[model samples]
Target: MTPRATTLADVDRGALREEAERALRALVGREDAVLREDQWVAVEALVADRRRALVVQRTGWGKSAVYFVATALLRAGAGGGEPSGPTVIVSPLLALMRNQVAAAARAGIRAETINSANVTEWDAVHERVAAGEVDVLLVSPERLNNPSFRDTVLPRLAADAGLVVIDEAHCISDWGHDFRPDYRRIRTLLADLPAGIPVLATTATANARVTGDVAEQLAVRGAPVDGTDGATASALEDVLVLRGPLDRESLHLTVARLPDTSAQLAWLAHNLPRIDGSGIVYCLTVAAAQQVTEHLRASGLDVRAYTGQTDPTEREAAEADLLANRVKALVATSALGMGFDKGDLAFVVHLGAPASPIAYYQQVGRAGRATDHAEVVLLPGREDRAIWDYFASMAFPPAQEVRATLAALEAHGTLSTAALETHVSLRRNRLELMLKVLDVDGAVRRVTGGWQSTGEPWEYDAERYERVAAARAAEQESMVEYVRGETCRMAFLRRALDDPELTGPDGAAWRCGRCDVCGGASAGVAPDEAEVEAARERLAVPGVEVEPRKMWPSGMAALGVELSGRIAPGVQASSGRAVARLDGIGWGGLLRDLFAAPGGGGADLGPDGDPGPRDEGLPVPLRRPVVEVLDAWHPEPAPAGVVLVESATRPTLVRHLAEGVARHLGVPVVGVVRPVDGVPPGRHDVNSAQRLAGVARRLELDLSPAAAAGLPGRAVLLVDDRTDSGWTLTVAARLLREAGAEAVHPFVLAVG
Candidate 1:
């Protein structure tokens, strides 16, 4: 039986809106479910008017509902005979995609997602989408640029897609707090889209500037002229923007000024149970998240660590644990930030401040979403700025490096990322990010085999990049101000996001009357003395395993280095230990300060002609950790001597550290590997291949009679100030093994 259908000309506007409301009610499984006026306006614009729109609303504002409702109404042929094509949503995170799929299922809308994790199912998914069996298709921005998808799938999808949705739209703007280079590919998708196909871009954290940028991209050029207008006109200025106040009334913001990392961990251990329900404890780095997770677990609290390093299955498990309230918290990095849905999350605590106020706002927005009151606390650490500086250093490689990458691609015709790495000095992550940016700018194209330059006249745009960098630095300063400012905490955040509602009729910032400063809430609440002491002990206990590099980096020969394949098992350095990662909690701050540049008051090398003085020794706190590591190592054939990797930059510190370890282990001082003939000082900034080549050419073992006679047939403790690529340790260990040492156990003050 053919279903009754009405054409667009015969459609009743009032009946269409009523049908949309019914869809919303079915979506939420509640008869009382009704769309907000703004949400309805967005839905009407998309389904009724077939116009593009941008929604910049706060978290929990039902931005998803706007798209889902529109998808249902359009797919059901609101005023037509046949079902419309599927809605393609460009989402960012897998967790978010999963949530959307489930939500759509509840609304009787069939949804499917294509992402890296489900590569094996892509063919089936594509078939379903092609056959119109799928009503909604979710894909990550990165997937859009995939060779197969871009060449074979995207054309059909874009041509027939009923609506194109870009979630986390802030990522499209370079000025956004979490700008993703791949998100820029959406502009290409938008441009290729057929006219009259409405597009919806949504984000919870875009400020006015980001809103304008996103809206401009959504605008359609040379759009078909409507008959009513009787003239052809572009749709560039027709983007409907719906922005709401960036305020979370349920959140009670506060800052707890702890003396150190130990105190902060102690406070969390003491206060987590007191919070209303399960939540997240955010850390600025993966190492810190692991550290916090371990400490909390030791305190008998249920917690898990979530970071980029975690396995896919484990991350999913962790998310499930949080959603089911099976765990107290998930100590996580920014990997868990966007689109995680937990309506009843009651609290959010930060071990360290994020680099920008915008990022902080988005992270904290996850809590107090469904509850009347949720605690949001910030434990600002002194080391936050240094971490920020480290990340900032990786932003859009210098013009020279970018040009080198482009030139390499042009010269080679097609080169993979690994092949390109040998031609450029940027590391893997930075190189990939740079390539994505260039790809979006039309300067290069990624093919099946690799990337190829398009010969487009691309400018480095140094001035624009510099402006962005300056803006980032200013944001970091604003974050610091937010932490230490005397103004109302919520008000300060709202003002930072440029929330119009923050200003009253008189044009003055309005106090939220909910934060610590405005509400007179005490920030000293903490765990009991016993728990604090336990947490202190757990944090103070330091030692991180430094896994030895077993495999040589590929493409060494291409870089003119004659090494390849896995390092010989017998020559590999045994598993190593460090006091801590330079970015971790506990002793990380001290190590960071210790290794700081000379201009920052850190130790400096002696005058050029010498190996530097050895009077300066290890600091007292570091001394105990080194001894603890040595005692815990307990090598099978106990070490017989200690050998130091001479540091051109901090000779005195490395010498003392090696000597202290030897004394504690009662092992004799073997000899040091000194820099040979004037091979310029090794650079710590280059790639593994370059660093290995430099170290190989520069460092040589001191083959003195004492060293040769004392080293054979016994394990030796190889000590260094730090280990980055482990190439230095690999070379040193191989040399020692060849010199008759049975094994070398590497130790370091810190590991990158």
Candidate 2:
């Protein structure tokens, strides 16, 4: 791929470019009513800066104009056309990219967009990128996550890129409503770029903490312009917000009880008149959604349902209908959030409680985008609240319970909740609840037996008095903080939420003054200093202190042990030191500190680095004297095979030895173990005999019936992962001789 620089003459810049510049300069120099004074100031801030600093302006504050001015400066021939790297803009949403691209095309700028939607042929895209035909490549983070895309396109962009723009930059923070795991990796992506690459992060909503987080995530210095909250409030005036009368509306909450979809269908039929505009009925499950769609269609209400079960094509069609006003209503599961832009929605009805508060807010926000008044109806039931409560539990776990669970695990090697509750003198149900919370934090993953730590857990003591008090306070405050105000309810909401829209007297008023509690079309009366101070004092109570913990894995001892001897077996041994070396000198001190129980015996000198307790524990098999050469061995074929048997008291031992030799030589090994005194010859325990035979089958060796054998001192090796004593190896080798071999040798992985 070759890089090409685009000349000013290459794009449509005849008279349109001049007109755009004129229009832009007129607004820049003088305050125009259409362009707010603050908006112009924001544009100047971006244009005036030599280095990039983020403009954390509110939504609908003419943020696009700031970029326009910057683009014009970069291209106005003040600095000659970019020699290499094109100015790159990294947008979070494809729609935002499309919007920005359309706006730029109108202004006569030579801009282009390359994202997953386009650029199907990656190699061709790279070629064009290197050629430098594109002035701006609008991309989503998802496209960048592709390894091929990163390896190919990013490098070329990095080489000549001047500016990188990130829209909705709040998503980069954990606190963002939508937290993408991969989004966290973008910090590294930005940092690893060429030194001169400057990042621009813009978001509609950001609190102080989120602003700081965005700056750190992007690795940039930020310059925040004040009054953004007011700007957003002004934009909301143009948006209609209708609040339904609490008692007058014909709204009765109905829940889909009884896995029966009949009740829900009947309710939708009864409420057809209320759902006048394009409506949405949210379902909790895909099966429910499907049933509702089927039953609703039978009753004749242009309904379509979407869930994860729907194919991509079906989902896209459903979304297109909703957006194009073709479908009357959409009955959907929670999979309908991202990139949904249906603005003129009249009603949104919740069939079930949503997964989380954030989800509920986002879904509700989708409606009444253009209208002055929008209605949202929530239907609550035991099932709905149960699902909601489950999520809430995961989101905000009881700190006392989490701390107790973690402490129990730390004290005991590993504790089951059943056992831990007994040990802690608590109920099993309560303990289970706490463990579930830890599970949600990604601190642990549930296993069949118990939980395994996935990452470091947040250190929290749910039982501390301070923590309990804080939780109680936060719970109470969420319910009682907002009341009727003289001004519009939206203003009170902005004040309560501390959104970027609570600034200035003009911005303090809602567009529609009839918002329920605030029935007046003006700003509410300002709170006196005394009331304000009291509110502040109440809010100042500190939140609970969070402590982090890491889940640790145990159970290494139960994986079975390895045995080895001085002699080399058929297998090769590397030059690394044995486990015993790590144990004798370095391990004891380490184990004492880590586990608080010191092993003082020879077993403590067992395998190097092995964490086995040294006192009164059964000696691990790996510490035995004989190095058992047990491997997935395949023996070679020979004219005569050797019989190998130690003095095997058990036929199982004899069969094991036979199988090992059989595999090594790729021939059947005959077993010949002498019967115990006065024992019936062929009446061995059939169950145990059958089990030994099964071992032979697994090793790909054929076991022979008892046969007379004789052979000694030729050359052969016995292998096993474990060896307790020398007697088994001795009898096994004797049996190998009785069958017909020249020699028998014994080996094991370890000697204890």
Candidate 3:
């Protein structure tokens, strides 16, 4: 019986046929003539639906071909409509961008990447984009964030943007296997644009979170499929997450710790067949990559190092060599795997444990690109755990420290980084990271001056940070447990690690079954178990309590205050935006200048309205003089002089007098208050009083006391380091009057 396919009138069969033919022709021209049946069906469905689609196929599933071929047809006017200006592809890596550009050119499509690693001239590219001369624009997230690019080119493209394709769309989610912070902002960028541009988010792998986040980021509802008028995923096979036996062939899984590069090189030399293919050797740091590259070169292996600092041209050349089979191995630090697709890798050696299992999976996934038997060698040493911990530590600040910082800001209103150090004692790097987290979490808001508690002062919740930290910790522990599980390693892995792809009943056939502990072989598991337990115990010691410490400049204690208590300075306090304010003292003008002046020897009063400056620079606070009173047995010059004192105490008053005598000679000063608790008072005499009173006028010294005993023996004097406030002198004078001292006068070192 012949089956007749029902063709709906609304479905543009002519357009679909034209587009399909155009794409087929382009593919044939590019020497990629073979198209799987599913690929054809997917293309037909997408053309009929008139919606962007996601291709969720595995690494080698011809995913890129689906999009490129479809693009070619659309650009060739096969869909019975004029194509948009260009197809905008937002790739995650520079190498991927380059490859796609080259692929497009080969297929007779005008495509170019906008990313410039090192270019003195970007004007031509920007102008081309603005003029809509290019068929496609490939850019990185960072490049997209450029205001110039966004303002100059993106708006023009938005109007007729054919499709916005995100290659590594899993990066949209933090829970994605390969997450990047910049990737999270793409949704916002697109949402702000003018046009209702169709977005095509594609990735080789996606967990539930990644899938959901990608859909959400692209503004898709329900499944990211055709019916939603958004995207339809090609018929992708269920992800084959293979978990195999811990055997000699599965050299990567057998290690408790990744071995050094030297050991890995030797292992590779011993086991790997030189089949004119290249491999990647991943390390935790650039130094490790360099070290491996040096040794590998010494061993006559074609090797190179790729790091963050690697030159772009050199990096491209090295990758070209690897792809061309001119190099056997490339030692790198997370740089080689994501963007470059060298189809014939024989091995991937991880020199240390990645910070997370997903990272490990991503790194290992670089190998076995072909259907051939390839190995992912994890040469973990005893130090690998520590290295992983170090990585995590760098990624996330101590949650407790973050919590403490939040609490301090809430309670104190605002804090400079210096004051924050005292409250939440953390190293400079850790503190910066914590502050950033706090800013991101919105528990604290970083204004120009410092971090202000956004919520209430008592809000010290680090629940989310702690939860993430704990989840990551559990994940790491699970990996360690996998390494030491006593059961059949393959079974343990498949059951525990959620690897569903190893379908055969006898998993041995899928991977190495002759592991040391498997097949009646001894792996010395007991010793390893002990070592694991010891390591766990060591890390289990409750992390040190995170608390903020109040720190102050040195020599502050000499002024009768603790080093930690005096003007907590770094940037500026959150509250009180003023040059300086002191009342009742004649030196108010001077005090203002002392505190408000900007240059050295003056406090940074900060702009009047803006919150004080942030403590990013860790400025030094100016030290002001202290007021010390001395006992001269001076009698009252005025019948009702105010008494001014540091602490309203006899000793401080006496010290103030001695210090003021030479500085404030002939200042008419009187102390009213006497010592409490029967403390000895300053000597009372007419000559001392007259001399103090006369000099007090020049220095503006004041004294006041409510009673004879409370009076500073009419011998009170006012002195302060800087005159940020006239209040010190004024306050001292009032106190002297209350202490029964006569005319109160004031004296200060310098006025604001």
Candidate 4:
């Protein structure tokens, strides 16, 4: 049997343009909806010319329209018979994919998604795709690298895919604002594509550098097959690059400079209702988002928290609620940034500034898409840089650590991620990211058992990584400058992206006249004294429950640790308490300062630092919160004693906090748990298994006879300065339970 042939040689250009318009009208459900010239050009390039293209346009500039229109035109053959192969789109976030699928459906295109969240439906979706019952298939980049998917399904998909789409294409470049190593797998996909297949890469944020890198990657060629020369493949120079002006005229940008988190929260609570409509409240961390959500709810505003930690169902509900204007706002982290399509979103308020202007642009762009005017505010906080620094610390592992990982992988035939962590000090996330980077570099391969070395010699590319790090540092500084009102906020961001539209005939920068700086608007927008006081009181009243670890991390025994399975409920610590997370917007500042290294100022110093003892006891404000927590706790049977975890670094601070708590509660001070066996202070910089192992070997119980005698069936409060892994409290709780304490309640000043 002969296969049917498909060709574009007979395509009628005039009819193609008409069909493109019809497709756009169907997609947007508006007869007046039409394609911009650049959009048309992109469609023509893909459908008629069969050329790869990169479209760098603003968030609402109809980038998706270009691809959807192209998909429609390509699927409807030039001669009009059976459709072509399915369009494969590599999307980043599930939210984005869900939106894309709906949009495609509007255009009468059958679209399906395969991602981590829809595991049960994967088989059905795959069957549909293979049976030619699907028009478009959206998948995450991570799925592209999955062992089974890559080994079996992907090859078939790539071979016959009509068109390839890389959404959020900036992620293909390391210098992108939100770089993901998994996106680099797209290069392999591009290389393996059969000739004449058009590929499209789309992104809302990409500087000139990232743009060039993505374009180059899109032009990469497949290896020579069966001794045939592959040098004739098209180079990236031929790739059509459509870059549009990134100015969003409807967005009225402003920065509200408040003195502290309390003032920021107060301003938000007071002014959120004044904003035009439902939108997002961007936060820098999950804890900050949760804190902001709670504060807003207390102020009678309907808001929800949206972060990576949010349950999938809850996230979908929150998104739906915001879209329907049922909630005033969603206090969210970057998890809500990309590909969320709400045409009438009226505002975006950042509780704290993002680390980079590109990131800030992407987030704020979520608003003012369909409306004539929408508010975008940035409430810059003092702790922004600290949060940036913490993230920067995870950039790329040191060269030494990378070398050690490669050595370990080479020694072992195959090792799972958990097993690899036991051999290296890097955390699970960072280690996994590093391995992905290596895999793309051809230094390693993920097999059934785990990852194995490819025995390929690879250089660390230290200079390139250093440059990327330096670029990030520069971006951070620019973000600080943005908040400082050093220039027109809109112009500053345009220049940051190297947008050509911002340059005038005389070579001076053009101001959009919509930002607070350009409009001579006041940066101080604090609410009245009473409201500010209320917010301050709310933030000051601090206490967070530290849910105990139920089950130990899997594969602990592979690390030579015997601990495994669920923690015995009888010996476990009750849900504990912390004054705040170190990254929280409220008590975070004070707690952060309290936990700062002694000699290094505010820097996070490791165990090597002195962290000199201070004479100051627990602050008066903090003391009140501790008592408030105790009053609210109402632990059954009450705590009979207080047990302190001896702090090797901040001994003075820990001792003062313990004594203060004991005195306030009128409870006896039980003997402290001391470090033993010459074990060094537990390093907070390592992985969970390693940290827990160290804590298990180092900590020892030292209960006085009187305390021991009273511990038969009494509850005790175990206090510590801070917790990163919570292993310290876990081990300490075990020790106290072994000493016959009926229940252990762990409390800490902060949790990192």
lDDT (Cα, tens digit) per residue for candidate 4, span 437-484 = 999889999888789999999999989999999999999999989888
User: By summed lDDT, which 10 consecutive residues of candidate 3 come out lowest?
Assistant: 542-551
- Model 3: per-residue lDDT, tens digit, 1-752? 12212122365765676556566567547444666655665455434443444544445555566667666655654445445446777787767777787777776777766654433235666677667677777878656545566566666665566566778777776555456655655655555433333456666556444555566556532343354433234312211111122122332334423233344445444433443356887888765675556555545666777765454444666677777877787789987657566556766767766655555655665665653545555566566678767756665555577778877887898776757888866875577656654554446655545668778343445585466567667667766765564555444444332343544575434533543335533222222334334434432321111011112222222334332222222211111111122321223344444434433232322332334422221112211222111221232342222233433212342344334443444443333222244332222222222222222332322322334555544433343333332223433344444444434434333322
Preferred candidate (TM-score higher): 1 or 4? 4
| TM-score for each model | 0.73, 0.45, 0.54, 0.75
Candidate 1 regions off by >4 Å?
A: 1-10, 220-234, 504-509, 524-536, 545-752
RMSD, every candidate, angstroms:
11.1, 22.9, 22.7, 9.9
lDDT of model 2, residue 670: 44
lDDT of 4 at 9: 68
Q: Rank by lDDT, descending?
A: 4, 1, 3, 2
